[model samples]
Target: MRVTLPLLALGALLLSTGCSGAEEDAAPPPATPAQDGPAEHVFAPGEQITADLTMYDGDDGRRTPFFSGYRPTIEFRHGGLSGECGVRLPVELREFPPGETHTVVLECGTEVVVPADDRGFALVEDGVERGTGEVVLTGEG
Candidate 1:
């Protein structure tokens, strides 16, 4: 199956929980080392992104076009530590035969970060969780 995931910076995990609040923009706090290194993660705000996805059908040697029409939905959630945050982009695909490959490109309009004390976002399809990814803040907040 064709699955595309976000390209996040090193040492950061993004998560989403169905919570909403003011779309506040703030400067990202200094990077905290998850392990001993230059910096564990970097968080910025108000950035743009473009991603290309390739989907392949496993059952058959044909590529599935289901993801081409998938709608991209965005959401945000809090992080475990204070000031940390995460964003989730959930793309919905039309039903297909069992074990069909589907791929598409997800264009994240803006780059945001996972708030502290919360996990990163999760990708859900038809109410079933498919994958997990991280979100980094970019640009001016």
Candidate 2:
């Protein structure tokens, strides 16, 4: 009788835990960013821009530089303007400067068109926005 009583209590406890209402009402975990992808950035037209290429990590446990053979190419686009630029990775192997900073130049029509106060420059890779840079129209285009 004692053993049967204890088993009944244990079963009740298990049933209660398995049917927890709190668990059903709990929120799900947030989504995580992609690990193997190029980061985005923005830049102004005709402005010299530099970006960290090592921030992107591939599934092979190596940075983007290793995959690109040290010559990583980034795509820049704003509105209807778009172009690809090749960047050289830093020769040094230090964490302080993990990757080389390549100057990105965005060109518009014949005259460089700076983004208005409401617009932004978009750095793209594989059709993804990795970074954005703001430009003040100083009439220097």
Candidate 3:
């Protein structure tokens, strides 16, 4: 009995000591890279955007005094007469969440990519943020 007890105790001690290193191996979930901290794109459903970006001068849309009237108006023309989607921003102004992109030609050759959140889109071009706009939710889809 004494021999069996010592053998069992040794076995238990060995087992416990062997598992002690396991705690170190059992680490938490791997963390994301620091550069990949912020999410690039987020899905937003049941919403639409109404952006008022600055574009070149035109007869149809209103003009802006900012940047010496070089940017754009609310509804400006691409070059002249014909209004086309021109502004090219990184973010896309969404019409509906996870749906098709916004299909509104503000001015000719003036494109506005919207950085949309749950509420609306941010009016930021590249890394420089010029402004932001709100969107109306249309559905829960």
TM-score of each: 0.27, 0.28, 0.23
lDDT of each: 0.35, 0.41, 0.34
Give RMSD (Å) of candidate 3 vs. truth: 13.8
Top of the candidates by TM-score: 2
Per-residue lDDT of model 2, residues 5-93, tens digit only: 99888888878878632457767998987553223334444344433332323432233333222222243234465555433333454
Best by lDDT: 2
- Estimate, for each residue in 7-106, the C-alpha lDDT of model 1 and write its tens digit: 2321123224423353547778999756332222333443332222222244332233333334424333443222122222235654433343233223
Q: Give model 1's TM-score versus the native structure.
A: 0.27
Q: Model 3 Cα displacement at 102 (Å)?
A: 23
Residue pairs with backbone atoms closer than 3 Å in model 2 (clashes): 39-130, 40-130, 40-131, 41-130, 41-131, 41-132, 42-131, 42-132, 42-133
Worst 10 residues of 3 by lDDT: 75-84
CA lDDT for candidate 2: 0.41
Please give, for residues 15-117, the per-residue lDDT of candidate 3 as tens digits.
Answer: 8877542457567999965552222222232222333333223342223222211232222122222112233232453222221233232222423333233
Superior by TM-score: candidate 1 or candidate 2:
2
* Reference-based lDDT, residue 96, model 1: 33
